[model samples]
Target: SVSSRSRISLIASTVTIAGAGALLAPAQSKK
Candidate 1:
């Protein structure tokens, strides 16, 4: 259970970072 929770948290953080990067990428490219 503990391992699964950690795995989920790690995936969540990775997805969040990827999402933020994706959002910023287009804006930066436009600039």
Candidate 2:
């Protein structure tokens, strides 16, 4: 069974990816 810790890890990974994408957008537009 999955633990609450595992759920939090998944959410953290998702947020990291989303943050990276958000950061990348402006850099791309500047080029």
Candidate 3:
């Protein structure tokens, strides 16, 4: 179950980072 849980968390973090990156893009472009 270690590998499975790690994979799930990895995916979740990836999604979160992607979403944050998306949100920051517009602000970055304005700079």
Candidate 4:
């Protein structure tokens, strides 16, 4: 279903953004 696929993509995007934020925090602290 399209709705299910959209939900999955949304979750994937949120996870990617969260992961990127986590990775960026360490670099920001070093500066």
Candidate 5:
């Protein structure tokens, strides 16, 4: 159970970072 929970958290963080990067990439490119 613990391992599964940690894996889920890791995936969630990766997704959050990816989403943030996706949102910021276009703004940076426009500059």
Candidate 6:
């Protein structure tokens, strides 16, 4: 159960960071 929860949170955090990276990418590229 602990492993499963850790995996889920890891995936969730990865997705959140990926989304934030996507959102920020264009701004960075524009500079």
> Global lDDT of each model?
1.00, 0.96, 1.00, 1.00, 1.00, 1.00
Residue pairs in candidate 5 whose N, alpha carbon or C atoms collide under 3 angstroms: none
For model 1 the local lDDT of residue 6 reads 100
How would you encode candidate 4's per-residue C-alpha lDDT over 1-31 as one tens digit per residue?
9999999999999999999999999999999
Winner by TM-score between candidate 6 and candidate 1: 1
Clashes of 4: 0
Candidate 3 stretches greater than 4 Å from native: none
For candidate 5, the C-alpha RMSD (Å) to the true structure equals: 0.4
Q: After superposition, how far is residue 28 of candidate 6 from its true place, in Å?
A: 1.1
Better of 2 and 3 by lDDT: 3
Q: Candidate 1, TM-score vs. the true structure?
A: 0.88
- Residue clash pairs of candidate 1: none
**Which stretches of candidate 6 lie above 4 Å from their native place?**
none
Q: How many pairs collide in each candidate, listed in order?
A: 0, 0, 0, 0, 0, 0
lDDT of 6 by residue, 1-31 (tens): 9999999999999999999999999999999
In lDDT terms, how accurate is model 1? Answer: 1.00
Per-residue accuracy of model 3 over 1-31 as CA lDDT, tens digit each: 9999999999999999999999999999999
Tens digit of per-residue lDDT, candidate 2, span 1-31: 4788899999999999999999999999999
In TM-score terms, which candidate is top? 5
After superposition, the stretches of candidate 5 with alpha carbons farther than 4 Å from their true spots are none
RMSD of each: 0.5, 1.7, 0.6, 0.4, 0.4, 0.6
Residue pair clashes in candidate 2:
none
Residue 25 of model 1, lDDT score: 100
**Runs of candidate 4 exceeding 4 Å displacement:** none
lDDT score, residue 15, model 6? Answer: 100
Q: What would the TM-scores of all predictions be? A: 0.88, 0.73, 0.85, 0.91, 0.92, 0.86
